[model samples]
Target: MSELATHETSAASFALSAEQEELRSRARALVEREGFAERSLEWEQTGEFPWANVKALAGEGLLATTIPVEHGGNGGSWMEGALVLEEIARACWVTAMASLGEIGVQSQALAAYGSDEVRAKYLPQIASGDLICSVCITEEQAGSDIFSMSTIATDDPDSGEVVVNGGKALISRGDVAGLFVVYVRWSQDPGMRPIGAVLIPRDTPGLTIDEGRETLGGEKLYALSFDTCRIPASYVLARENGFKKMLTAFNGQRCLNAAISVGLAQGAQDAAVAYVKQRVQGGKALAEHQGIQWMIADNEIEIQSARQLVWRAAAAASGGFPNRHDAAIAKVVSNEMALRVTDRVVQLFGGHGWLKEFPAERFLRWARYGPLGGGTPQIQRTAIAREVLK
Candidate 1:
């Protein structure tokens, strides 16, 4: 038997801890109570940020689980955060992405590398959902190639401020973010240490947030232009080794991104199963068809397998340092798995699947984000190959 098959037969192979299970249950209940499915459609159509949903999640202590307790967080493990994301994404991928931004990548970087003053000022607000943080890394010329980014942040010794000038594309929730952790080329000198990160407030001068750009999922995404934007020197995260630090924080994000993919696939599977059991054709329920049964069976197997990979990466990340290679592998598999599962679910639903009211089509659209965001499947594959070859 395959390793995945053997593990599935074991009772404890995919079991969550009691606390983790409770967290999942509560998060699921909250999403249901908020009418996430209905709201997700509304938000998608309107292109509005879900502030009320974010506040409700914060009230449930589901916003900043990975931040330390002293920083107004619950001090939860990465596994717990991933569990919450999975439950939330099962209901609404947009809201799940928002939660990931607040708690996963940008927030983790600030907590780990931000100055004490920066942390004290922003972390609590983030935990409470008063402020949303966005990470600015992808530029017009540097989608997957971080080193090719042309956005530069020059230090002014006389002015005691950093002048940032560049544009970032495809930034999630850019319109709603109160703060942004922007990655830029800090120096023109020849060296790998020329990159740096800085925090820029949304209202800072010379910072322009463009109109929202429509994606396959119809979520609110924007491009930012910083034309000689200036912020205090203290806002500088790291003048050197900024890229490495940012990448380290991004490993945790990759895990959460994988969890989102798994959750979305699971959601699609559940909807398909429920529909098949109720919809009858040829004087019999759709679920009674052997071909339909095979489709459902395949979905279950793939979802379980992808979920295990997500959990493994999250578990590895619970330690101080995340395993980059593990994160890359999990992300590549879960992302592709989500696209496949959602497509299968759409097939299972037949003509009704294409309708917006059924949610299969919506899930399919959102599933496209998995392979493209956080990191592309090709990029993850390349990273994994490099690690293994070394």
Candidate 2:
């Protein structure tokens, strides 16, 4: 963001504009029409990518709304992305998770800092939903502590290219991504200045992608290994002082993560509401039970609170990433709120919630992924404290 842009007043209104509402409606319709809710169970069971839903998103023009308009996208803001993601997640967490790379931090980093050659090569395909990029940031020693990452991108004296060595664990989209935006130590410079990033094509030699453990949300995580992978110098997104740039992108991701969490919690609530209305207990409907009513009330309270926070954070950014402080606060609130709300939904379902055959248990499992993905609630709290102290 430019100095002038930074000074612009952030819109605090939580109400969506006509365009934003239209986007939300489109996403909601797409998910329901395509039966993503039903298909989510199959995805968890088969472990297959939801290719049909991806295409459906593309058809509805929701696939790459976050990328710059010049790059074949609508150049929508994070708020726009949030509206879409939340609706999608409300129906299927798996599809929402799959859409992250294209509409998330990885795309933002690549679009903001990548060389024209790299962005021009990948952004168009991503906007078209024909491609997805796995962001490689987490290493064995680094998850939230990205500065502790040992991945190195050294200039090759002989080949006049960049040679990368080190690995990332628990990366999404590795098995199917066509491109990689990898964060690495770019120089011997002390502190965070040396932490930069590079772009490596998925097919680059010595770049290996291997399957790893499945996540609670039923998405497969993968491990990335770079064994002296050599790439053109043009692939360098930043050589130094890129940490701030990446973080700006991450703030937006945090907002979106919160938005999805809000949606997941609401989805579970939706299921619980329908079930309680129909299921009879003792002599009356479960909805009439005081205990169930109180649980429902609490779920609504948490969901609405998280939604408002997410909207504020997301709306803070006009055409760029949101304020870091706002983003962190929203993420932590939504992450914990979703966990509580989803758990209550499971309990409301009684024995049916515990069975894998039901949706309530699955919603709880999906909510577990909220804090674990963008950053843990602990990490977000630390960030919040640092902001306040500063």
Candidate 3:
């Protein structure tokens, strides 16, 4: 396919306005200059959350890219947010995981469901990256089935608090998140509506954050447990209709995941191309070899295709409301595309690719996480099927 053929027309049409472009450029320059070029490896080896890098991102206003300017955000569109994530992902995948999760969820949740006072209180600090929030939707038994969640939020008549119970698994940025948008079932009405969401500060009583696990990607995963954790009644995002509210924010999360995968695919392809042009065998650079050339070409084709899917989803999202059908399709396609492209990069490099000395192995590892996290590939397909059939 031609490069022009791959250009995302819809995305190109609603291209980031001049102001958005300026933000992207400025962010790109900062990451290139100040980001951890080599220390990412060390961070990964140590299984650390890369707080210093995240602090740098906050200083640059990336955390606020999607929030409105009135709320102290950079006030960029979802497309611009995607551009920012792409650049950050290119620099360090771990940082992208942390920054994107916070911005994506905060923008969607605060914009749609937050009460005026809620927005006024949290949006500014969150945009400034001074506050980091994580969505607590996936529970121990039910990963994607919101209706099947077992976490409980009981109303305490005496204290006028909602007492929370149960746990969340594999939560990204779990340990370090300063705020949590928790999904829980009302004990008085577990079957009445299935589940509800509550926004709780990290310091809420009876809340425990266990050490994060070692996931396939360098994700800092945490398991959260609530033992009669009491949050003010005002902490409830919306009493009975919390599932709908969580879904609203979830749409943006899926789109952001797609964007990150697209960036990872592109980064792997670029690295492979550079490596091919320099690594010679049989008296000629690997780029001259038919086998290597074919691999590089295929990677390029898939990367661009993935990029279009991502941009299309971003364009739809930027338009005030994203088409969930398109977003699901984009997530599935981009996740699969990244897996293919990164695996090919690993193949092209032969033995060297398997070694940590080269980043291909790391890219391949992180690419696998794309499908597992943010709803599995199986869940995505089911969602797309439901939307298409409906």
What is the lDDT of every predicted structure here?
A: 0.86, 0.85, 0.77
lDDT of 3 by residue, 36-68 (tens): 546667778887878888888788887788888
Worst 10 residues of 3 by lDDT: 1-10
C-alpha root-mean-square deviation, each candidate? 3.3, 5.3, 3.0
Candidate 1 vs candidate 2: the lDDT winner is 1
Candidate 1 local lDDT, 243-316, one digit each (tens): 78778888988988999998899889889989999999999999999999999999988888888888888887
Better by TM-score, candidate 2 or 1: 1
> Which candidate ranks first by TM-score, i.e. highest?
1
Order of the predicted models by TM-score, top scorer first: 1, 2, 3
The per-candidate count of clashes, in order, stands at: 0, 0, 0
Tens digits of per-residue lDDT, candidate 2, 7-122, equal: 21123247776677667767877888999888888988888888899888987779888988888888999988888888888888888888977887778888888889988888
Off by over 4 Å in 1: 1-14, 189-191
Error of 1 at 97 (Å): 1.1
